[model samples]
Target: MRTTALLFSLSISFGSLAQLQPIAADVYRWKDLKIEKEQTRERRQVLEGSARDLDLLEIHTSALEPGKSPHPPHTHDDVEELVIVKEGNLRVTIKGQSKILGPGSVALAIPGEEHGFENGGNTRVTYYIIKYRSKLPMNIDRGKQAGGSFMIDRSELTVKTTDKGSRINYFERPTSMAQRFEMHVTTLNAGMNSHPPHTHRAEEIVLLISGSGKIQIGEQHKDASVGDLIFLGSEVLHAFTNTGQEPCSYFAFQWN
Candidate 1:
C-alpha cells in the first residue's frame, strides 16, 4: 500500500511508541448500532480503529446462527482480541483446543494465536469482540508471558466489596497474557453509585449486563441498560448510578 503522511503518522503512533491513543470518550446504546450482514454471520461496529481515536483499538458485536462460524480459525499479525459472550453457547477454537463459553464468559486471543468461534448450541449466540494493538510496552517482560487463548467463565468471577457495591477482576497484564488491559465486572445496588463523577488518563469500555443504570459523560447523561457498550475516553469525566429496582452489573475494561 502507498503510504501517505497521515498513514505514516498512524504507523509510528501504533508501533510501540505511545504516540496516539484510540478513541476519545463516547457512549453507545446497543439498540442504536446498525448490523452489517454477511453470508455466515452479522456484526455491528461500535468503534473503528483509527489514528484519531487511538492508533488501533476497535469494538464490535457479532451474532452467528446455531451452526455457523464467523470465519475459519485465524491469527492477526499485531492485534489482540477479547471475545465476551453475550448470549448462547459460543464454542471457541484456539489452535487445536476448543471450549464452549456461556453467556458472560470471556475469551482471549493474543496476536499470532489461531482463533475462531461459533455457536455450538441450538440457539443463536451474540458476543462482543474488542480488538486492539498496544503501542506501549507492558509492565512485565514479553518473554515471561504465557501466550494463548483461554476462557474466564462468569461463574468464576469472585465478588468482593466496594464502597457502595462489589466487583470481580477478570483480567490484567500482570496476571494474564494481554499486554494492554485489565477487565472487571462491577455491580451497584439499586439507586446507588460507587462514587462521584470522575475522569482518568486511560480509556475504557463499559458493557452493561443486567438491571438499569445511568451513565453521565461530561454534562450529558443517559440511561444504561442491558446490551449497551459505553465508551469513556481519556480525561472525559463520567459517572454511573443504578436507576432500576435491582442491582446493575457491567463489564468494564480499560487500557493505559
Candidate 2:
C-alpha cells in the first residue's frame, strides 16, 4: 500500500509539469494560422512553447476594428509582453502614457507595468504580441532601472544604409526576465542574403514586415511571406535571403 501511494504521488507531480515541448527553429506562416473571431477583434495564435532561457514563450496576433480594445489596462506580475504593429494604427498605453503608432512600431511592457492597446485608426489595426517568462526569478527593479516599459515608433529610429540594403536599430536593453534584449530591422535587396548562416547565444525571432523571403534553419529551408515569423533557438545557425524581386524587410529580436 505504501509503494502504491508513493507511485501515485510521483505520477501526479510529473503530470503537473508542462507537457508542451520546446519550439524548433522554423518559419511560422501567417496564412497557416486559424483565426478565432472575438466580439470586437480577431485573434490568431502563432506559437506557444519553451525556449532555452525562458520557461514560456508564446506569440499571437490580434486585429481590432476601429475604436476597439481587447481589454482594460492590466498588469502582469510574471510575464513580459512585446507588441509589434503589423498594419493600421495602434494606441498603446504603458503606465498611463498613450501613444498612437503606425506599422512597424513596437511596445515593450515589463512585468508589473500597466499596459493596454486599442485601434487608434479608422481602419483595422493588427499587431503581434510576444509573451514570455524567464527561467530565472522575476526582477521588477532591474527592469525599472533599465527604463521600465516604453513604446517607440519605427520612424524615430536611425537607419544605416548599406550596399545591400539598410538596417534600423530599435533597442537593446535589459528587461525583468532577460539579461539582454535587442531588436533591429534588416532590409535585404533582391537575391541578397542577410548574412551567412550565423549562431548566437540568445534565441532570436524574425518577423517579416514587407516582401517575401526564404529562411534557412539548420538543414531546412522555409519560405516566408509578409506577416510570417521565424524563431531560431540558441546556437542554431540561421540566415534569411530575399527571394522575391523586391526588397524584403524583417524585424529581428533576440534575448537570453
Candidate 3:
C-alpha cells in the first residue's frame, strides 16, 4: 500500500538474507493495488519490496499532468532508477542534459546524480519507475557516456524471432549500479509459450504489456492480463503461456 518513494531511505537491507529466497509469494495484480494521488500526479506501487542480494527493489507507475513532474530533480545516495515512458512525451533530465522520451523509451538515473522527469507532451504522461539498490558496493552509472545517465528508445531495437513469436532485447550492457539486469520485449502467439515451466538462478519479472494469458508458478497457475506482473524467484519453477485468442506480449526483465 506504500512505495519506497524515489527518495526513501535504505537503512533496511535484504542483501544479507539467506540465499535462494522464493518470490512466488510476491505476485502483484495491478487491479488490486492501492493508488496514491496528488493534485499533479498519481501512482501505484505494484512490487515495492526486496530480493536477496538486493537491498531494495521497487517498481511503480505514475501519471503526471502536462508540464508537471512527480518530484524535483534530486540525487540519492544508494538507489539507482530507471524510467520507462509508457505513454506521452516524458522529458528526462539528468544534471543539465535532457531528452524528450516517447512511449516505450527508457532512461536511467544513476546514484549520486540529480535526475527527474517532466511531462513535455500536451497530455498526461505515464511512466514506470524501477528503483533498486544492491547490498554490495556499486557505482554511479556513466553507461557508455561519462555523465552517469543513459536513455534508449525501445523502438530502435531489432526484433529477434523466437519459435513461439518474437523478442527484442533492450540494453545488454551493464549500468553503473547493475551488471546483469537484462530487459526485453517478448510476444507469444496464441496458445504458445516461450519455454516449458522451469527454474534458474536469476530472479525474473514479467510485466504484461498487452493481451491476456496464463502463468504457472510451481504447481500454481493463474490468469493474467495487462498491467499484471508475474514474478519468478531464483530457482522457482515458472512459465508463461498465451491463452488468449490474440498474441500476448510482455516486457520481461531479469536480475541475477
- Models 1 onward score TM values of 0.84, 0.93, 0.85
Query: Looking at model 3, which ten-residue stretch has the lowest summed lDDT?
Result: 6-15
In candidate 2, how many Å is residue 89 off? 0.6
Off by over 4 Å in 1: 1-24, 51-53, 137-148, 161-163, 174-180
Worst 10 residues of 1 by lDDT: 135-144
At residue 17, give the lDDT of candidate 3: 34
lDDT of each: 0.79, 0.93, 0.78
Candidate 1's residue-wise lDDT over 1-256, tens digit each? 5568879878776574453345555667788999899999899988765432245777888899998998888988666778999999999988778888898899887666689898989999999998765545422235136545567878877889987688998877632223456789998988998579998887778899998788998999888789988888777889999999998999888766
For candidate 2, give the lDDT of residue 113.
79
Which candidate, 1 or 2, has the higher lDDT? 2
Ranking of candidates on TM-score, top first: 2, 3, 1
**Candidate 2 displacement at residue 45 in angstroms:** 0.4
Candidate 3 CA-lDDT value: 0.78
**lDDT for each residue of candidate 3 in 1-256, tens digit (9 for 90 to 100):** 1465522433233334333233444457878978899777999887755676576777889999899988788997778888877788999988888889898788887777788889999999888898887766785543335445677877677889888898988766566656666888899999998788888887888888789988888788888898787777777888888999998988888765
Model 1, backbone clash pairs (residues 3+ apart or across chains), number: 6
Q: State how far residue 131 of model 3 sits from its true place (Å).
A: 0.9
Question: What RMSD does model 1 have?
Answer: 4.6
**Predicted structure with the largest TM-score when compared to the true one:** 2
What TM-score number comes out for model 3?
A: 0.85
